[model samples]
Target: MKLNVAALLALSVPCFAQQDPNAVEAGRLVFRMSCAGCHGLHATGGRGGPDLTRGTYSTGDADKDLFSVISNGVPGTEMPSFRGALEDANISRLVAYVRSLSHAGAVPVKGDRTAGEKLFWGKGSCGQCHRVGMRGTAIGPDLTRAGKQRSLAYLRESVVAPDADLTPGYATIVVVTRDGAKITGVEKGFDNFSARLIDLSGRYYSFLKDDVKSMEREYRSVMPSNYGRMFSANDLDDLLAYLASLGGER
Candidate 1:
C-alpha cells in the first residue's frame, strides 16, 4: 500500500521541533541526501534495511541507544558506523528524525476473525497438529499464546515455510522397532542400541536397535505448507491478527 509520507513527516516534525529545530532540519536534509537512497524516500525501508515504521526499535528507545548503534554500527553485518564522518550533534539529529518516525498508535490491518476461524478448523486443517485456545490435538505446541511470543514476520515465514525454524521440542521423526514396526513421533533420543519416540498421544515409545528396521528422520516440517495459496492476503492477515490477539489474556 502507498503511504502518505508527507502527512507522516508533517505529523512527526513538530515533535522534533520542540527538541531542536536546527538539528531536525539538518537531519531531514542529511536523510534526504544520504539515507534516502537506502532507506527509501520516506525512511520506511528499502532493499538494504528493514522497515523502520513497523519495527520495534522506535518506541521507548533512548537517544544514547540510537547514537551507540549508529556510531558503532552492527558487527558482522553490512551496516557501517558513522562515528568518524558524522558529528555527535548531527548524529543526534538523525536519531531524532528516526525517533520521530516511531508511531506506536499506527493502525493495523483489519482482519476477519470469523472467516479465519472457519479456515483454521475446516479447509486449513491446522488443528491436526497445532492447538488454539484448548481446541484441537496437541501434536505440536499450543499456539494460543504464540502471537505474544512471536513477531508478525515470524508468523508469516512460519506459515509460508513450516520447516524454516523447527522449535526445539517439535521436530518430527520416524522410528523403526526391533520387530520391523515403524513408528513416527517427536524425537526424544537416538543411539545405536535404541531410539525414543513421542507420539501425538504423548506416549513415549522406545525401540530396540536389533529388532528395528531402518529409522528415518525428516528435517521438513509436519505443518502443511499450502497456507499461502489457500488463504487470500487479507485472509492471511486476518488469521495472523487473530493469532496475534490470542495472547495477553493472562
Candidate 2:
C-alpha cells in the first residue's frame, strides 16, 4: 500500500515529542555523550573546555541564546558544531537543562541599600571602573543612570560577566610595542599611521605606526575576569539590586 505525502512526512518525524525536556535528564545526557570528554561529566570543563558551571558563560547566558550557540558553534574555538549531531528540538531541551543548572534562584534577595553603598565603594571596587552619582572613576561608563538603560538581570551579568556582551565605546585594544612592551587600553581612535589608547588611569596615549610592533583588537570585553568569584552570593545579589534602583531614585 502506498502512503500519501503528508502521511510519509508524519512517519518521518522522530518519536520524541516537542515537550520541553526534563531539565536534569537532558543535561545529564548532553553531558555524557557530547560534553563529558572536554567538559567534565557534570559540565565542569576540563583541559579543552572552560568550566561552564562557574564561568562567565554560566551566569549571563539566556536559554534561547545558548541554544543557538550550542547548535551553531563558535568559530575559531575548540567548540564544535552540534547541528547535525543533535536535532533542533533536542538542542532546545539541552538549553533548558543548562539554564536549570545555572539558575542561582528565581528570586533575588532583597538588598540593603546602605550596605550595598558601602560594598560598592569599599569592597566591590565598582568605582574603580564605573561612575556613580558624579563620583568614582571614569575608566568605564557612568552608572548614575544605569537603571534607565538595563534591567536587574542585565546589570547582574554586567558585574559577574562583563565580557559576555560588550557595550559600544567600551571595547579594549591590546598593543605590543617595538620595545617588547605590551599595553592594553580602551580604543580611542585609529588610522593608518596612528592609534590612540585610553588607559585605566584615564589617560589617553597616542602611538605612531613606526613605534609600534603589533596591535590586536578583541571583540570581547576588557573587564577583569573571575568577577563571579570576587563576591559572596548575597553580595552579588545586593549589588545588582542596588544598581537596578539607581536613576529611578531621582
lDDT scores of the candidates, listed in order: 0.66, 0.66
Task: Report the lDDT tens digits of candidate 2 across residue range 109-209.
Answer: 37766677788888888798788887888777778866434445556777788887676667887789988998888777776777787888777788888
Considering only N, C-alpha and C atoms within 3 Å, which residue pairs clash in candidate 2?
none
The residue ranges of model 1 lying beyond 4 angstroms of the native Cα positions read 1-101, 104-107, 188-194, 200-204, 208-211, 248-250
Give the alpha carbon lDDT tens digit for every residue of 78-153 in model 1: 4577888876666777877776676544335367767776777787777887788768777776787665445555
Question: Of the candidates shown, which would achieve the greatest TM-score relative to the real structure?
Answer: 1
- Candidate 2 has a TM-score of 0.53
Error of 2 at 241 (Å): 1.5
Q: Once superposed on the true structure, which residue ranges of model 2 sit more than 4 Å away at CA?
A: 1-109, 191-193, 248-250
Tell me how far the alpha carbon of residue 142 in candidate 2 is from the true structure, in angstroms, after superposition: 1.0
Residue 100 CA displacement from its true place in model 2, Å? 27
What is candidate 1's local distance difference test score? 0.66
